[model samples]
Target: MANVIRRAEERDAASLQHLQAATPGMPEWTQVHWLGLLSGDAIVVIAETDGEVAGYAVASLLRIPGEVVAELEAIVVTPSHRRNGLGNGLLRYLLAEAQAAGAIRLMLEVRTGNGAARALYQGLGFQEEGLRRRYYRDPVEDAVLMSLQFPQEAVAVEKGQE
Candidate 1:
């Protein structure tokens, strides 16, 4: 069956936690965190395949003076769903929403050892911006900060031609 990406709802809290657990490098967030994302400047979306939650992504929208920026908080795909484009679908949905919300940039940090995730992000036009020392626990590792900047839409009217 094809994967369907949709907005996350309150009912998805438990399933989101389950996905997090099934993902090895995912951050451990509590129910409170999931609840907080449901109704704020945050954007959350989940991918479902065969009536099961396959992956999810969370991001926050920040209006910075003249531009809006999005910070990706978490994105995890179930073990069985990895490498099947579920993560890519979830991120594409989130990026479209962010762009509609006026966000011109997206930022995220991934564990340095997570080659799969890093490759996915890189393939999607995200560039490595920086590195954080010893960012992960359990298995200590550094984090590679990545960001993608969207080009501002050009105005319909030309400067001199108008």
Candidate 2:
């Protein structure tokens, strides 16, 4: 499969939106919200495999006061695309893209039971920092907050001294 990861274009909204809805363990975001993000500063990325959309992820550069952070809003891979390093590629792309945009950190919240996602994030240097009570509905899943420091090059430098 020639899986290509690229920014989600407006032309992909309908297909991407359907994929988002079909994705298990993903939040239901309105079509309007998805379209707004595509039209705004948010980063909506899609992965195409064999000429078909395989997965998508959404991220945002958040600014507050003097602080800047990159928030990975959603990362969803069609079950068919799982276990193929597609998730890893999308995350690495987001991390590098966000860092280039001046993000000092990357943050996200995943369900406590999502070991796959947790492990993936941890492998990329993200750490568990906190939790949100009942952040997900339709079963009331708690959110486990995770974050990774930006500029991964700095992490390598610091590790080299250890």
Candidate 3:
């Protein structure tokens, strides 16, 4: 099946939320929250498989005094789409988008038990920076903080310079 990945619009929140609901250890977000994200220019990406949402990646930028960074809030892929590169696509898309927005760093926290997600982030250059105890409340899980620096290449990309 063909897959198309792009910046998520307000209309996609519904489908994206549904896909997210299928995943465990994730907080359910409301449409109002999702809409606010798109309207504010926060990073939100989605993958469409045969025109249906298969996954999503949400991130936000933080500017504290003189420092600015991007944080990945969540990255989830439906069971039917796991192990098919959709998650990686969504992640890389988020990294590229955030980098273009002047982000010097990309960070995320994944449950230590989520080996697949950890492997994916590591494969994308995100190294474990720390650990948070009881980071997830749903089933009570620990989280490993991971991060990757945006190389000079991030500034040299010829596409989507805006």
Candidate 4:
């Protein structure tokens, strides 16, 4: 399947809601939240396959003491589209967007039971940083924190040219 990853627009709210509804294990975000995100500082991207929203990823840029960080808020893919690289595509797009926005690090938390997600993150060079106990409610699961740090050399080179 050919998948196109693009920035989400306000008009995509309904399709995003529908896609989220069809996906389990995703955060229950309201329409208000979706709209707010589209207008907020958060970076959101959706994967489209054959004219349908297949998956999406959200991240927020944060200014820390000495660096900008991108915190991955959510990532969800419809069940029927799993294992087809939609998830990976969404994540890679997010990473590129974050880096372009001056993020020096990308962080995320995933349910410990979600082996597939963990594998995906690891495959992309995200290292396990820590764990949050009882981070999820519905099933009372732990959350594994993972992070991918951009190479310092790359950041330095970019800064040097500025």
Question: How high is each candidate's TM-score?
Answer: 0.88, 0.87, 0.90, 0.91
Per-residue lDDT over 1-162 for candidate 4, one digit per residue giving the tens place of the 0 to 100 score: 678999999999888878777677676787778899999888999999998898899999898887889999989998888998999999999998888777898999999999999999999999999999999988899999999998876666666744
Q: Give the TM-score of candidate 3.
A: 0.90
Score candidate 1 by lDDT.
0.86
Error of 2 at 161 (Å): 24
Off by over 4 Å in 3: 152-162
For model 3 the local lDDT of residue 22 reads: 68
**Deviation of model 1 at 22, angstroms:** 3.7
The backbone clash count of each candidate, in order, is 0, 0, 0, 0
Off by over 4 Å in 4: 156-162
Global local distance difference test of model 4:
0.89
Q: Quote the positional error of residue 52 for candidate 1 in Å.
A: 0.7
Q: Write model 2 residue lDDT over 1-162, tens digit each, in one string.
A: 799998888888888889988876666777787788889978888889998999888899898785568899989888888989889989988887776666779899999988999989999899999999999987899999999987656534434623
- Model 3, 1-162: lDDT tens digits are 999999999899778767767677677887888889989969999999999888989889987675458999988888888999999999999998988787778888888898998899898888899999998876789989999988756655523443
lDDT over C-alpha atoms for residue 60 of model 2: 95
Clashing pairs in 3: none
Model 2, TM vs. native:
0.87
| Window of ten residues with lowest summed lDDT in model 2 | 153-162
